[model samples]
Target chain A: MGPITENHLPRGLKLLLILAACRGPEPQIPIDPTRSLTLQTDWKFTSPFSGLFYDYYRNENLIFSGDLRTNLILRVFNHAGDSQYDIPLKAVLDTLEDINSCALFAPDSLFVMEVHSPRYAIVDKQGRVCRVSSLAHALCPEPGNRYEVSGYSNGIASNGRSLFMSAAWWGDCDNTGWDPSISRFQYIQRYHLEGARKCRIAKIKLDPDGSKVHFGGCNILPHLTDVPRFSYSGMERVLLNGKLFLFSPVAPYILQLDTGTLNVVHRIPIDFLNGPAAFFPPPITEENLQNGGDLVSKPSIAGLAYDTSSGYYVVAVLHEVPIDTPEGENHLDRPWSLIVLDQTFTKVAEHIIPGKLYRPNHLLSTTAGVYVHRNIPGRAGVVGPKTFHRIILP
Target chain B: MMRKVIIWSVFAVSCVPGSQDARLSRYLQEQIGLTERQFPKAIVVVSEDGCPHCDRAFADLVRPRTSLRDCLFLIRIDGTTVDLHGFMVETQNVRFDDDRSFKKLAS
Candidate 1:
């Protein structure tokens, strides 16, 4: 047979090649939210991080749930979704007042931070309080920074000697009223385990000057008042490979910082298909406040998790849906996209998840798969035995 | 006798809407500084426990209509003590149910 050159190829084959060359990159596979591996637990699953969105740590095959005050049962599950152990945390629950953030500082101990005060405790796996201390006197005041340790602790993690937490900061830190003129900022501060402020690592401005419309309080303001979904301002923290990485839903980059130097070493850019969505909520005017309606909702990066086994990163992109669609009205019911990136941060696969079946928030990634909250159609936050659906990535 | 009393109490609470509504109205009026003349035709209850987006949408829907402003009383159930100073400045009849009396009535 003669060499099959371009001219020698059939007409139909030539046309097919031309069409294939003109076509864009391959489309993402549409993932059916219902078609997933389910994790049935004996106890009802309540989010451990009270009001804040959180991700739990996965050590080897075991996944440890957060130890915040809102946790009903401190659960430890294997990669196979079977419960290894569950602690009620009754012994230490009473002692830790309004626990907001929890981190495993030691192999068998949990470092917990409070919501109402600058107090923290070290509790063991057996729910026994090892030590308690308050940070009110320890934190040295910054000249311009009105650092409020209580309530503003967004992302908290411990590296044995120090604890790091992000604070959603605005004017005065009281969060009494909304001022559009002043720019909002997110301050990540490092502190000694004993509650003393070590250094301010990073301070990134949250919103463009006067961009947001309303500020109800510190809690409501960070998440945006009247906009019910998770805010782009909320920072997600991960302690990987002896380095701390901070990622905000809104920011396009994951900040890798060295705890010892307190310097942001690397700014790893998240290469999404078409960058992160541009979020702009409708201006909450005085007239709207007085009289009542113009609010615009936007899509956001719901959650981010790193897989220990595969050295891959899985991010949940909460895509915006039409307001008229009944199922898409709530933030939890919105359509989602699962983006899988390799160790080099290259996009490996993308899955388009339809709304109303699953919530991509509070993602727990492991060797087996990424675990997401399986929601019943119509009803929101219904308690049941089976907690999450495991989505095994490609 | 105790069981009978419990059943009767449950019946009184569940079945008696006329007295309960009136008491609730009076209680709400007093709590929110509502006048007898300014009776609300619609009452929008926004709870922190409910979907935040839906609550915000409801607030947005009712805000633009001047007719709804006079007839509607927007009651918000906050998790913590809400500073009503900002709420009072608005022309809309917005009230924070701090005492959780509304939650009690619903329960």
Candidate 2:
């Protein structure tokens, strides 16, 4: 065989090298020790659990909260943050079938959230799947989980024109031989949504300097540092002013990334809360795991949104009762707590909500208030079917 | 030459997703039907094992929630090339051309 030369290089291989070089370096978001962005919200919810999925419509003209079931409800909220029935989702998702996953909706989106064979679809106002195009994936390795870590799209959000997606990563290092102390990760590929801005996928490094953070299982690493993930919440992108901000569903900090470059420009760590796993919560039982591998439980900021009307950052905190639960059982079904932070990301108010969050973006912060989904446990009578709770914080 | 073919056949026939977490395989098999019987888009998400964020994300994806099966997203977390591609019997021969975007699942 003739000696291989530059001319013999496959065209695609050459293009790949060019893309890799231009892909740039992995993101390095500095941990600002000076930012004490934590707060103490003594406020507590007094209402019964009512609804879960919350999304604001038309600049807070309408607020909708539903059980994410057959009932897509719209509620009207007064300036006092109280709510009553307004209408239902413009697109009926409850009666809709064929479309899997949550009904991804945003005011600025061109197509309602739909995934199909080629893997892109759009739903109409009538809750019908349209323009179902199954584009073939190039079989590229998912950017975030390089070592074959299992994960999923966390939630869906849009920036007026383009859609932004965030995913969760979980796997074990027991036999992988990777460091069990400090976390190693594959660089997330930045994606360009057909209509959205250039999205640079950054690597997630959650070495939180001895703070207690939760992974899937009870097996806690003594320490973890550098926590940054760029997945946006489904209800609303972690958008403030004009920038795309992101938070690890299980981490204690928020990241602000450059819109064009998708690089971390600034990071505000939620230092007030304890992190790096003050202690590991027990692993989910095989029964509770259902099918996923066992997971460690710990404190986390599941969802965050900047409420325009109230001018507060509504954060959903999922953890075992910070204080002792009345039953004293370390139930994995920790009620999602709602924390309100100011422009500077300081905790201003907090309330213990009554619901179990199944997804990181299950907690939706709207202009009126926040909505959270409560997953039903095995004991139907105890937790009941999944529902959303509309909270009015004082 | 015939021996090589025989060995390859055995390998192909035995190429089951036995290496995958039985729980995850079942969960994906259950949830992934986006259209009339069409499977949702399957993507490989990469993260180091034993990380907290990755752990939480992995659990959230695998856990079955609503009876209302919406858009089923297919996620293959980690495993050997065989484990990643070896889903159904027909997929035993499904090979990704390379690590490039929009890889057509050549069945």
Candidate 3:
């Protein structure tokens, strides 16, 4: 065979070469089944409001409270469910309104997104403010920018140096308020930790007819039925090793984005079992709600996490139950499940949570199992510590 | 006598919402059994489906004046856990949108 040259390469060989050149660095971490640990916390987070974000960092569970109504604080607890420290964030951020969500990254840093403004703050583990930066400048740099950043950011992820957030920029702003239907752009933005803006990496398409399927809302005004109350059109993301994985609420596949160029590398399809009807929630309408429909959301990917030990991607799904079904009484009663996908993006095991005893929004993928919150915080009639149940695949 | 006159004057002026949302005004009149004279100047709606912090922010902004006759707090009760953190009380100004009438009207 002649020495392979760029022009003389076969079609398959050329394609492989191009793919190899474009592919980002993939980190291979050993998965140890024995390293999996079951976690439960005794901290009773009975705050009257809901807006806390949870994550596992360095074998310790971190809970950040950013509800506008409550005192902003970061509560750290050990694996034994004992409180280590509760650091107040209101003073740290010097803002009374509060943050929407937070991402805890390497070297013990927290990237917090604000609820009332287009800004973010970096703070240390001790609740000391490291730097405060403007996302408006990074995102909407155009003069007299029409795209207004919504008050709430859905999810955040960081790869130590760059902070990423699922943010929405709406151009339809008027006296009425910001409209989600006419949202100009939805992006997973990347910003430098020091305050410099990076690239507007991923642009997520807004589903025009998604209002009925996705619980839609405008950030400014409340009490309008046509407007609803919550509208977050961003993807949940996880930055593992060197690759970025994104799970959109409306998309059926998880996208792997190249970290440096911010381009889509691979699309991992999620095969939701149709027979069991697990992790699949059918869409409903306003008429259904008027006719005693209990839930308004379609099946959505609530969160995504990666288990370095097992090389499994755990996707948390919220299932929408029919109104006639008994489980449709409350959102918390709706079924949720953890779908485990192997390194090759093949479905391994799907565990449907047996009862309506846990919150589907919170989940941590571990070697032992996926740890999920037992109950939603601030829920009425729920008492005791914030507990988590491990879902071991059968 | 002076205090009573001032109180009456305030009530008369604040009987109607200064800038009422047309749909909400209609909803209050048609669904909630509220007369035109009973119209509130401001309305705060709370639901579990929405941002909890926004709801609390609204509640905190209106807590000092929650007893005002011109302000109304509508708590959606159906298919939601409407917790106002003790800010809601049994008063004429506060009522549950139990049947989701406002929800239906708004949607």
Candidate 4:
């Protein structure tokens, strides 16, 4: 063939090459919630930063993540997902109390919501514990537990000034808490921080009556002593427009309740909310669920989160995929898939995490990409090292 | 009881297909880079020169099968070493202490 040159190339080929250059940096891949993310472990920190949803971003798309108690350190990341700096907390907050769960209150500080008590602490960037005060009795009131069983408040998220916490595992009528065989009702409480001085707890009546509708707490039964077909069940959430939307790493669904009315406004069913399906008692209520109805075939929803830039929800589902073997037959398989959906709860895109690459806890979408961190907890206040995977999506 | 359990395990292993779907076998072959046609008898964690925990995990999941040289998965326990072979569990009557890994019946 004569010398192969650009001039000899077809008009379409020339145009394609020109357009590719105009597109900077290989047209950044839109994060495929279904695909495995790139694992970045360069940020060096000793303590376990257990806080989920590292979504608070400042200038240069720099996102902030830290815990007033967990790791007692702050980490900043550039839009490129590179760690900028580590801010130590021992210098900031003087209250020796370890935080139960915490979050990035703003660009300048760490918001520590007390683990068992009613105090809220704010540790600023300059290593200063700015505010420490008791929440109104209404917000911090003793949870009667109904069954008077153990009380645990988790899934903490904030909209700058206010804080939201949902009850993770509630006991059944007899206190057989978190038993997969039996279902239990659930609720989340909201508190307006003293930052504005209201510091009062907003009493959410929880639909007040038991008969009409009560959100069910997901399951995590450990006594089975055997492998559970599906063990994806936990409540974690985000607040939008004063409403509390709780999701699970277990259940394949998102629940929206009116904080004002405490009425379950919507139970969005993620039909493809991949997870192990069998052996779970219909979730206290069988209103809306995308479970496959059995254990033989199911999807694994490892984590869920909301992306501000896209106004869409990113759900990490470890789906049981079927692959043909050398025997010429297909067997069901489980792998990670990061799914993105619009605010309207419509499926937007599906990205495969490619093989059993990640075990997701919280999925955070950002200018840099997405962060999947599993809360690998160690014994009493000690947590495992920072093991998180970050990947750019397309 | 032990004899019955072992006998039942052998029969079950021979009779029933593994508990996992084929996608898992593909993951072992593709993601973790395992070889095809290799009958995985046990999963061994090839420790990185001197990683103790990796050694333990390898030992923990290493339930000797009838045929040792037939196949073995050397996973790295120091990092995110997914026991893809762990998912290739057999539906045999053998009690799966944790359902993490199971031995293949002599074929």
Candidate 5:
């Protein structure tokens, strides 16, 4: 072949270059570091959990909590504090065998929860199961007898018209071993507010033969060039100018897709507010180890919430540090941090949550108060109930 | 003769597998007890849905590869499954209680 001309370049490569060049530098926005409030509850729960907080009537009077374990959403409150209601999700959970993940589709007045039995159910304000859809049934007919509906929906968002959610296909990941080369087939999907299947969406599959692909285990590098292979995780959707902005926590990247054309128009890099590996504790030196310190780090983004008030997305990251002890076990404490990014998906602000906070799975903004559910370890037991903080966002 | 030699060289290069991918596969098998032969038939079973660790596990299993063809029959499984025979091959090291059972037979 003679010298390749511009025509030789693939359409994707050309478009990528054009978008990269045309897109102006991301605008910087200031973040109010003190713009946060926390409401602690006397309750606590065991690990391996999911939760949601919502208000039914938009009365801004009653707030509710749904715990995955009790399989019941109950009305809860403190006599001295503001009035809060816990609406039992049993009506919805009863329709499904088990719940995997849940979200409050605020715009639609519906609570969408995913079941490991391979179904999504939409519950109404009265806690009645309004609609139900099987994820496996919609995705594949012969989805195969070997296929197990992996319970790992990382992110859930809505466009007022429909609910968009993403899940990492884990069945293939677990049995196939932990090779980075073979990872990437994890699937993501979108659903209607009524729990109807919309689309399975696309997945980036890594080469199994492992020629061009290289796996880095669990950690993700900010630079794409650093790894030959990686996958998307924890996706969040925001409607910007009639288009959909998709954000993934794993890659810390955002994609602007035109709804009309269904084409990706732009890819933006998101900068976490905390420094690289900021979630993890420092390595144990001889001095530190002697003093009862060990190497500990929790450097993953567990939650993503779009804050419409500030025109930015707030990310909940779990930061952990190992306690200095003889066993050198990791004392993973959740220091909730918010990384704010503007419409362009640029990092604007970063704030670390103070006090003893556990992993936060959901962040909700309501007229009543900002509700957040903390992911507590299962050992905490079913009694005492898990903590759900209703903070009045500043 | 030169033309023939050049053609043969090109064919040989095409047949040779990339070392990088092989190294990666080896690394994965060693670290996670996952291997190429097993990946094609293996199914991933996650502890919880929407859990980040499960996400990481899936991401690592499906990352892109250069030398390997997509021959693996990968599947996603939930942790609640009482029986995993269809997806997981019974291994000697894996043990289950009366609540579950796994018999290791020659694959």
Candidate 6:
């Protein structure tokens, strides 16, 4: 064939090149045929804590079930569906207070953070506590009196032997009570698998006017609200392209932070396909409250998973309006939905699970399948012990 | 036996037409200050077997919210706490632990 000229090129090819130049480089997402496999069983148990979400970590021999309540990591066989194993998580000295977030260094070594206690623990698979570090230790270089630790570690992610943790420091340093200003100074710390702090990244201080602080290397920018109402949760590291994809539930935004400088490389705004304001629950009127109905807004993006095959991010989002119910009164009525997004985090397709499936607490992808834990009544807290449904998505 | 009869009597009285629903509405209103208009279109009342308070709470306190009849009425028997799963299934005419489906009871 003769050399093609610009004049002979199709109209679409020219348009694509012009757009690509402006947008710069993006991750390539592959398209694959869809398939799903469901595991049967609705294991139920009441949680000592309030939330019913848990993390599922598996190795060749065992699958460890960790909850946000107790430090106990229930161990079961990899193939044991709906059956409890004989071995329980080994006990450590420092209680795994807030089992909300956990990172496994290997099959045996793990890091657990207590979001409420603001404490960190490195424990072996046998459950022996290797090291316990408190936020007070970092804040006070010289301590005349030891500060009480809160053990509330919201997010935990690992990079080989080193673990990264997000800490929320609440209460006044002196009184140790809830102080709005005190919470603004949240920190992201890197530690050895044994729980020793290597380096810490402090949150950018907000201006007096409450404007965002623009620090160069911080993943959470200064402009972001640090008030208790706006703190993030469930920070996990996605090791792809030598970059860490951090998922924060507070600003409820996903941030891509550079591991070296600890600076945010990109911020992907996450919201329901319908605008954020549009999905928010209607204001709670006296009528709704009295009727025991709560006007609850669906979360824009709650649980996120990376699909390696498609190079797309699959997020578990609240697709329906949460039923209006009294606070503390559980409403097991809403349907959970999942949305698949391309590299830019723009939604690709929305998948609403067909029936009432209670509340979904966590979403994780494994070689075996895509596991999602549903919050069943009497189930363990946010990191509930029960494995409600295992959806082997194709 | 006598205590059981008394408990059974209370349960029976609580289930009398609209008594359960009325008492529940009143209790919610009094404690949480919920008005009849503010009641949910559906409410799942969870209880265990042999607990007189839970029975009374459901029958007398929860059943009266007919104003919110649009709201669903579900009785979730605690299989962990009681053996009422079979009894609940038969009486409520629903499946036992069908987490896949939520059937609305016919008025």
True contacts kept of each: 0.00, 0.00, 0.00, 0.00, 0.00, 0.00
Poorly placed runs, candidate 4 (over 4 Å): A1-62, A67-72, A82-85, A91-94, A139-155, A168-234, A239-244, A258-263, A273-279, A282-300, A306-311, A320-334, A348-352, A367-394, B1-107
Candidate 6 structure quality by residue, lDDT tens digits, A1-394: 8898878878999888778888955432221113322223222332211111123342322233443213334343343343333223445423654343455545556555554554656676566776765543344323221122221222344444334444322323355443454332222111111111111232222122331211122325333322212222223344443455655333445677776556778877666546441132222333443431232434444455654455666665554454553323332244445666787768777666532343343544543444555444432222234443454333
Go through the candidates in order and give each one's DockQ.
0.03, 0.02, 0.03, 0.04, 0.02, 0.07
In CAPRI terms, where does candidate 1 land? incorrect
Sort by TM-score, top down from the best? 3, 1, 6, 4, 5, 2
For model 3, residues A101-167, the per-residue Cα lDDT tens digits are 5655543566556665655566777778867665443344343222333323234554445544444
Candidate 1: where is the Cα deviation over 4 Å?
A1-61, A66-72, A149-155, A158-163, A170-233, A240-243, A268-275, A278-296, A322-328, A377-382, A387-394, B1-107
- Residue A94 in model 2: lDDT: 33
Candidate 5 per-residue C-alpha lDDT over B4-80 given as tens digits, one digit per residue, 9 for 90 to 100: 43344345433435774354356336543665565422222222234444433443343332113422222232223
Candidate 6 or 1, higher lDDT: 1
Q: Identify the leading candidate in terms of lDDT.
A: 1
Which CAPRI category fits model 5?
incorrect
Residue pairs in clash, model 3: A31-A309, A225-B106, A358-A374
Write model 1 residue lDDT over B1-107, tens digit each, in one string: 43443344345444648867777677657766677777665554444454434443444444344345544444452221111222322344665553456556644
Looking at candidate 4 chain A, the ten consecutive residues that score lowest on lDDT are A188-197
Quote each prediction's TM-score: 0.54, 0.40, 0.55, 0.45, 0.43, 0.49
Candidate 5 chain A: worst 10 consecutive residues by lDDT?
A188-197
lDDT of 5 by residue, A145-212 (tens): 12222324433333333444443334332243544544222211111111111122222111223211
TM-score of chain A of 6: 0.54
DockQ of candidate model 6: 0.07
Top TM-score model: 3
Over A1-394, each residue of candidate 4 has an lDDT whose tens digit, in order, gives: 7899999989999999999888865323233444433223322222123333333443334444454423456676554446666667775346735445555546666655554555656667676777666442333233432211101223355555444554322223244334454333222111101011111122222111211112223222322213322232234556543456665443446667666554557776665543331234232223323342343333545556655555667766656543322111111124456677788877777776543233454455554445665333212111233444554432
lDDT of 3 at B57: 49
The lDDT-based order of candidates, best leading, equals 1, 3, 4, 6, 5, 2
Candidate 6 residue B10 C-alpha distance from true site, Å: 14
